[model samples]
Target: MVNKNAGDIQSLTRMNQLYEKLLNEVDVGIHVINEKGKTIIYNKKMMEIEAMASEDVLDKNLLDVFMFRESQNSTLVKALKTGKTTKNIKQTYFNNKGKEITTINHSFPIKEEGRITGAIEIAKDVTQLERVMKENMLNKQNGKITFDTIIGRSQLMETVVDEAKRATRTSSSVLVVGETGTGKELFAQSIHNGSNRSRAPFISQNCAAIPDGLMESLLFGTKKGAFTGAVDRPGLFEQADGGTLLLDEINSLEPSLQAKLLRVIQDKSIRRVGDTKDKEVDVRIIATINEDPLDAVANNRLRKDLYYRLSVVTLFIPPLRERKEDILLLTQAFIDKYSTLFNMDVKGISEGVKTLLQQHNWPGNVRELEHTIEGTMNLIMGEDVITIQNLPGRFRSRYQAEEEPLVQGDEGDLSESNQTLHEKMTKVEKMYIQRVLKNNGHNITRAAKILGISRQSLQYRLKKFGL
Candidate 1:
């Protein structure tokens, strides 16, 4: 109905092109969510930070793409709800691909003539940087976690730790394979600290959190005039030349770029995005994968040749469920940490809470346990010990589901043969004691230490069990 001319359309298209260039050129991530929590605009840098395609994110509810624990857990969602600015906040969440992503974000509401319209968030991916930078002061204010900080008493963990310590002795490329929250970056930082390059820089980047279109330039740097507005810049490799460069989620990188990365690793040199010549670099490469490297290789997510090269020194961190013995120990450590920080008198957890914690599968691994304790700490109301009531509702429900039979008449599964509660508990205790004993090579003191019981009590149990 309105008069629309070709020149007006051309001008509008040019303005859109300019805006698009701005979104792509900026280093920081930009995400704009509508009032309804749907993504209206997600820029290239945001794509890099989230490692999501525009088609995957745009026009979809932000909550659908991310597995944030709560609806308010999303800064953009929170901004929309509160209509307030949130700055310098650290957010940890799981993406659709199941990779854990951590970011430092600044979020604020966007308004049109004093009326709330949508929310915008500027983010910097700190998925691995949070380990070294220790920037997440929002919740527990945790700092760098070194080898000494790693809590591993189980044989599986001890073996992995010993192998990681050995990798520090050499600068050979190391591949740390583990699930999310298993502390792959923590091990990487410890390796760097123990290595000869401790004094130099330690840089970390999550390949899954970066877009492949910008991956090459970010990793290999760019020269002036490489494109319009391109400036001569040093890539992560050069910045970490004298130190360690940790590439988290390495398999997320495109195959073409992976091949280039392989070339750089092989040659110890890198060619900038537009530079004609290659510059030699001395960097210790450490790469991590959330899933099994073999699975990644088979799925073609990771190149087989690159895997072989980078895995010259490989370390696998077992998930939390595999080593339940560490759960209580880690819980206490977290309690001590948070209590010291909050100055709360939370000395210990109740027996019921302990049973529940140990019963939990901890799909998020150690990180989940840490946060569970942290969240519980915030709920403490002059309680000396944490109880089942203090746990989050979801935790309580899950624990209940595990303890009770889903069907009312499934008694055979739990109370088979009309066994008494004490007898069943004692059976579980004896089984655990035997497993710990075998794991510790039948060492009494060592097993007792792991079990958090006195050596005398352990001896008494052994005598009673006739083992």
Candidate 2:
């Protein structure tokens, strides 16, 4: 009897301490009601949070003291009715100031002899969460990107965007080969954004910019005192583990380093510079080569083994000259950007300027065109419209001659038009196929890869065309 009495006293002391902690230290609002539905135990903070005094709530009928809207559900009532815990019950409750506040309520029933005695209710403020959810819904409704922020509407650009989205669905390495200014980085970013690894960090390194000696350290990282001026640092591969690492100008990698890159791609692991310890990484590699990678391999500038591994899902972006329809669309976008930055009131491009833009062959592609327009905007102060007179002098005269209509003699020269549509298609197909084949140095496997098709499919076509 003496031992049982001591144990009872210890239990009572612990319960009292728990009650005191809940009343004074807990952050959430807590309320306890008796079998008669009258307030038996409630926290001072709960009253202060509701902007009411203890006298206004203590010993009062709990249901009568608080007002609720008809739409608002009661977890405490449900807990009492069902004799179970109700979790994450959401509703809006009006404070003493009559302002509606959102909350998530949790409640549990107290029972004795299988009969419901009372219910304990706890409320958590969720106004911030509610606002965040609403804003996310609005952003979704607006059809804005939650990832890549690329903006373009041209059909060619759309195709590139679609390919980037498709690339994200696979874990295979993607090779984006394009001209210097054809938005290779944008495509890489879009692929990362659309991927499952978007939440992780995305790292980009320009292989052409880094020195041969430090390339390995930059890519695979190094330990402290691994070399001169070397502190312990995680390399791009370790930093981007479970995410993506884009190697821009990959063809520029030294032949020695290319072999190392191939091993990383094949094994999905890395060994830091001067460190014998090998570490496993799951980095998704995306490489961009401005030049023909196969040509680099042929000249012994790039390793053939690494070239094959990095060209898993190859995508080639056509130059601006080939996608002429996108020129005006990209022009307007660049104009809008420069207009905002330069604080100009320039409205639109004139008819003459449009004709000249359409006729000119953009050798430098999109980047050159944007720079030219930006330079033109700097020269003109107040503009009714951007005319041919405002354009760069070299483009104005050379391309201006191509815009004029030809005479009857020129119309009769239809030799170029006399070719049948089938013949024209064959010509285009042969040219593109030959380019791919030559770029891959007659390696059908590499050619098929560069063209983003199967080797067997290429073989069938090559046999059909007698090439």
Highest TM-score scorer: 1
lDDT of 1 at 402: 39
Q: Candidate 1 residues 1-467, lDDT tens each? A: 23467778888999999999998899999999998999998999888777789999999999999887553399888898889999999888876765557889999998889888899999998866754343245233335446887887987788888889999889999999878999899899999988889989999999988888899999999999999889999999999989999999998999999999999999999999888999999999999998757668879999989998998887878778678899988999989877655645578999999888887768788999999999998887767789999997877776564344333242223343334564456567877899999999999999999999879668756744546
Q: What is the C-alpha lDDT of each candidate?
A: 0.84, 0.75
Q: Candidate 1's error at 444, in angstroms?
A: 34
Candidate 1: where are CA atoms >4 Å away? 1-144, 401-467
How far residue 11's Cα lies from its native spot in candidate 1, in Å, is: 75
In order, how many clashes per candidate? 1, 0
* TM-score of model 2 (CA atoms): 0.57
The alpha-carbon deviation from the true structure for residue 412 of candidate 2, after best TM-score superposition, in angstroms, is: 14
The TM-scores of all predictions, comma-separated, are 0.57, 0.57
